[model samples]
Target: MGIQTIPGYMTRGIVVNGHGQRFINEDVYPGLVGIEALYRQGMDVWVVLDEEAFEDVPEAERWGLQPPHVAETVAELEKGMGLPEGAAVGGDGAAVFTLGGLATDDEGRVRDRDGGPIAGPYAAGRASSGLHGGGYISGTSLGPGTCFGRRAGCAAAGAQQ
Candidate 1:
């Protein structure tokens, strides 16, 4: 069963795949991204948090959550989580997911493989591939989108003129 967790659940700890090794950034998109990593490792992963990081989490945020498998140190956390000894883990399945989007021009116009802009249809924000060609940057999921969305909208509006 999946747990509704606060973002802090990720920012504070490290995440490891089924093999108990760090794969992607702990704070990556936080959903499909992390899940994909899990699939890559072995489809079963764990989050190991040290007592200090666990305690640092706010009580309110932990609301309605299962008590974390407690451990005083990393080794214990790994053992508790059934990971290999000394395995570093956290946010087992929280990294956000990102996929390559429709290729777009600077004006947010979708382009074909031949680099020709597709007529009429346009994309912006995460829907457009320009901002994040292969990967994404944290905290940028929205800003560029808003800006590009506006540009696309304006361009679309003018094209209708």
Candidate 2:
């Protein structure tokens, strides 16, 4: 829908012509959601990913370089990941592609270095309950303030409870 220029490259696009064989891109923004809908309509995808697209996101949330064929192999999982009667792995098997995932628990909840809760779901500076940081542990290198923040909140909550 718009064009943006990064330091190195510029992505310029426009509504050239809308009609297609049977499918349309629907949205011009690279960050638009529901990619499978386009797939369902027989449109093969060509994602041109780069750093600026993921700049604001936490490092853990980014996918570095999954093989190009990974999406092809995982195609069955895209449409709900469930099988008709045989059961399947697409619908609920650690599924990892959705729009709201950035704000939701897809990247896992943040917990403290101890077995305590930290900031809820910041992309950074807080510990994680499920996801691992660049360090060797599930919770490390994050700002300790987040852990104490939860502690104080928990104390207040306990007093009220």
Candidate 3:
């Protein structure tokens, strides 16, 4: 099996690390950036979504997933999650730690920091990085792979000529 990058997820809630403190803005950067922040604090992190946020989740999305553990107020969720007293709680969110993969350009061509595409190689799926700018929304993982994979395939075919 390959290493997996478990991204943090939250539709609506406050995210706090094990120390009962927030490290990143939940609304601003909810993707890898937020996950990176949680990693700095410690392995243990929790996203406490209130009832309102839970209700916002679309029915289709909730199909297979188990119901979330919820509380009436942020304070209550914090208590259940073992966060420190008076920990600042914010909006809906959650995070999971996962392995980072290769950086790629818009065309699905692997590239260096300087933006030069690497020769004879491409990457898509979880290994690609060009699709999501900041926060990766739910239901985006497969879409990017399918879209960029097509581009990468075309680019590869052209390069062989």
Candidate 4:
């Protein structure tokens, strides 16, 4: 799962001397502002994917996370999703540019202009889900398929006690 623009959006950047660290920062975003700020701290992000539109939108009206920066558009975002640039395949038909914006109509059910997932849309995480023996690593979230057999076994053992 990627980070969204809520209060505690998960981030992974370096802590430099003058950079904000959430609590002490006075700006809306406490960490690096953008790629420049991140690079200024001698750190490079593999992919800068974070949910935007993190405003006062209601939970039901909200689709998914918005793209924080204007430059972090769909075209510049697919590299983070393991897709080729201007990919013309699933999601948006045969000609999709970016996979990172929320292009919705009055109904809020269309792919974003950049071909990214719209708000409230359910999208598969861009990462691979295959483990050595179906175990979670660092980045995987606790989804449904992640752990069942082991949990059921543990539950059965506990019930016996």
Worst 10 residues of 3 by lDDT: 1-10
Whole-model Cα lDDT of every candidate shown, in order: 0.62, 0.31, 0.59, 0.33
Q: How well does candidate 3 score on lDDT at residue 10?
A: 50
lDDT top scorer: 1
Please provide, for model 3 over 10-80, each residue's C-alpha lDDT reduced to its tens digit, 9 standing for 90 to 100: 53655567656654555443455444554565456666555566667665665545434466676776677
State each candidate's clash count: 13, 3, 12, 8
Ranking by lDDT: 1, 3, 4, 2
Q: Clashes in model 4: which pairs?
A: 52-66, 63-119, 63-120, 64-119, 64-120, 74-98, 75-98, 103-112
- lDDT per residue as tens, model 1, 75-106: 77667667777555343433344343477887
Which model, 3 or 4, shows the larger TM-score?
Answer: 3
- For candidate 1, report its TM-score: 0.47
Instruction: For residues 1-161, write the lDDT of model 2, one tens digit per residue.
Output: 21222211212111111121112232322333123323342233323333444354344544353213122332332332221323322232222321121221223344443535445433323322223322234334344436544554565465456
Residue 55 of model 4, lDDT score:
37
Candidate 2 whole-model C-alpha lDDT, 0 to 1: 0.31
Worst 10 residues of 1 by lDDT: 91-100
